[model samples]
Target chain A: MNLAFAEIQETIRMVQMESLDIRTVTMGINLRDCADSDFEKMNTRVFEKITSYAAKLKETAEQVEKEYGIPIINKRISITPIAEILGNATVEQAVELAKTLDRAAKELGVDFIGGYSALVHKGITKGDQTLLDALPEALSTTERVCASISVATTRTGINMDAVRQMGEIIKKASELTKDRNGIACAKLVVFCNPVEDNPFMAGAFHGSGEGEAVINVGVSGPGVVLNALKRHPDADLGQVADVIKKTAFKITRAGELLGRIVAERLEVPFGIMDLSLAPTNAMNDSVAEILEEIGLERVGTHGTIAALALMNDAVKKGGAMASSYVGGLSGAFIPVSEDNGMIRGIMDDALTLSKLEAMTCVCSVGLDMIALTGEVSAATLSAMIADEAAIGMINKKTTAVRVIPVPGKKEGEMVEFGGLLGRAPVMGVNPFSSDRFVSRGGRIPAPLQSLIN
Target chain B: MSQKRAVVSVIGKDQVGIIAKVTTILADNHINVLDISQTILQDFFTMMMLVDVSELEDLEELQTAFDKVSNELGLKINIQLEEIFQSMHRV
Candidate 1:
């Protein structure tokens, strides 16, 4: 009896040419242990603990890569919000801590350290207030440090108080380091149910219920899926979905296998797998291309959003079926520079920040990969962050920005990140200011309808 | 009679002496071809053969016999355990 096999390479079984490897396998290290009454001791603990716990991340990632042949792009550390840890310290001390955290990440070869953050969703706690106050300086001075502030939630509604204050804080953050602040705000995400085990950046922090030194892998492959779709351009939606589902299964298997090996070697519990379709700056890398191929002529058209909703939902469904513990922003990422199509489209007026915002409701992260003028003020920066957080809190999704205000550049200019580092063209900003409105510092109380309900 | 019957299929382009080359090896191993069907679908040739392997003295010897036919003819072949095939295609 003969059992025969068909040649897969021959029958157009979708060849993935430029697949995006998992960008970051971030290990979120909660730093509640850094809490101390003595300010100096607290600072030392924050630096020492984060550095010590995260020390093995790069080495572990390299070993895992060697064994599995999967390249881990970033080895990152996320911690308990620094504001909470720096409660007893002065603003200057907080900035120093920012520097120290940035230094620690650099020393460990970690790309960026997150959890320079705060949560004022309910009300501004004393520690949260301290971090908020020191944000402008803390962010301005640090090199490889990133920060986020969640000023609203569905349960708590919008914190008009924190929101207004953040307008000033963001304005200050932008003004102090106007060039980087725009880009920095993009990395810093404000969210509703900000997941703890998120292995992505600035918004990615060690939320409360996580293990000590676990490895969480965030697998991103929009480039692979997009290329697959291109091959089956004539296939019906069902056929397209089947192709995506099968492809996701194989890609996910790669991540799971690598994560298990890393966890075993490190002798720690493996964390949840993040299967977000993170894009890069490659020519074919884009969520827009998929949407464009689906129907729309360009990404930001009126029909663009509906197409995005379909693509994002389809991706989530396919990814969810493939992996058991599917968490993080497990949807399509519409980041600008990361997707070369988006970058070109935005420059040519095919996409706008407002249109990007509309699509964010259906997609995963909000206002990601956006670039603005370096001259843009922090108040506007905060206003922009607040606007995105408003979307996340209302919709109960993880929306974020990697808004880069390219230093010294005006609108229609680009800031380049060499290699997988994407380049973003600075888009025009809302000339209007919410300084007076944002100055009104009272918490935008929870939606009134919800309270009665 | 062999205790169980398994079906093996070979599909490809048929050429001169393809069946002689395949059936000769089966005969040499005493693997009596129980029933056989052959068809040409367009340019491609296909064949399904039922063999009584349960009585075969050695499964490896029968397999080696089929392997030789496969190497010479460039045929696509599938040999399936009856139960395994049934379980895969169960109602």
Candidate 2:
């Protein structure tokens, strides 16, 4: 009711020229009830439930986009983690289930369907073990299915067994799709303390605690924030933070409005609006560039973490103010492949794997969309996952790893994932191996932070 | 009842008859202009019109109508629901 007339043109300019967008409107549909002892029946039930529930998802999103004049970039679906429903499932049955999910997603016009996943942070169940065993093949054969695993949490600590196995799983998945630059690994993420209702792909899933079906929205606008910063180039850090907060507020508001309308139209409960500053490969839509605009010459140079932390905090504060429900990994996403500036940072030797690991401590997600040399050992991958998990567990924040080891690819070579997945130059990992350490497959006990209760 | 309104924004090089042409199209679609403002900054023109689209029978038609004006005048015109601006910039 209090919309100012003066703000109209500015908002339009943000959309038209600054690349502001509702990054994704993901429908999280619980598939737990679709399970059955008969695998074929179970698959059919899963397909029917998803197709019926999300039949109108793309149409409604397009209608909303046309009505509001805001681009709803991706309309996707997340389901209840398949492992939870596939107890006593065989490896072949698990693969079939993944294919079912992929087929259902394609039928519903959804780009990606997540939750081909398992949660084994504390211990692996029979279903989780089977799903993990089949994950590599399941992901390679399916075109639209994504898989995620949670192997650590603050309360229970890191599960070294699952961590070590994921290293091998990623290797096999990468080998299976070596023809496509190991794109299969791009659809998989390993997490410590994964969120219940994230709307972002390769990580989103319908948490067991969620209701029958829900709609979650992810809003992204690094360009909007950059434009705000450019307006006050002479402003101090405090003023810079203020500008980012204000810009985030406006972006989150638009996302919330779009989410509510889409949910209402679909007759699904509105989940949460994730206000992460996700970037694409396009120019001027990069989070690393936003960091550089904040007085840093290079993204991985000194003071980069401090600048990133400030921007992440400001984005959350501003986004939290705009939406009543703010959840998911709501901060700045620094995926190297998905963001052009991050790619440039690597190409210029301004960023490295070690520095990216350090930056994950302050950002939303961890070590996302990073490709390493083909010869990097599985134990090293496990060690990397352990490091990121330790950061998340100690800080009690959500952190994940989506690293791909492209076969026959080395540093200084480009791997093109195409579309929103973008492309990246293979970054070198440390030459030293963590084999002996990773081979000790035992739990890393929870830190003192877990004793908060 | 809540009023259904939309903000129709236009931006391009400064030219004659912009307002007249835009208003004529809105009138053709039975849209009533609630408020409007225009300004010129260094040969560039920008205009914002808050109009009641409650009587709008077809959103697609209205969009095509605006597209026709935009194509003919070499301007970028956008029609967005008022709730978007209210939710974004306002508390």
* Cα lDDT, model 1, residue B83: 36
- For model 1, how many clashes? 30
DockQ of 2: 0.65
**For candidate 1, what is the recovered fraction of reference interface contacts?**
0.02
Q: Please provide, for model 1 over A1-453, each residue's C-alpha lDDT reduced to its tens digit, 9 standing for 90 to 100.
A: 332222111111222245546678877787888788887788788778877877777888776564333467788888887776766677777778888898888889888888888887778877788888877787777767878777676677777677666656655565666544343444455565467777777678877677666678787777677776777878876777676665565556556666666667767678877777777766566777877776567778778887677667777776676567777777777777778778767877988888888888888877775767767765676677677777777676776655666667789877774444477888878899867666666666555435432
Residue A179, model 2: lDDT of 93
Model 1: residues >4 Å from true position, as ranges? A1-16, A178-187, A374-382, A406-408, A417-421, A448-453, B1-91
Q: Native contacts retained per candidate?
A: 0.02, 0.71
Query: In model 2, how large is the Cα lDDT of residue A206?
Result: 91
Docking quality level of the chain pair in candidate 1 = incorrect
Q: Give the TM-score of candidate 2.
A: 0.98
Q: lDDT values of the candidates? A: 0.69, 0.92
Residue lDDT tens for model 2, A12-43: 87888899999999999998888888888898
Q: Which window of ten consecutive residues has the lowest lDDT sum in model 2 chain A? A: A1-10
Best by lDDT: 2
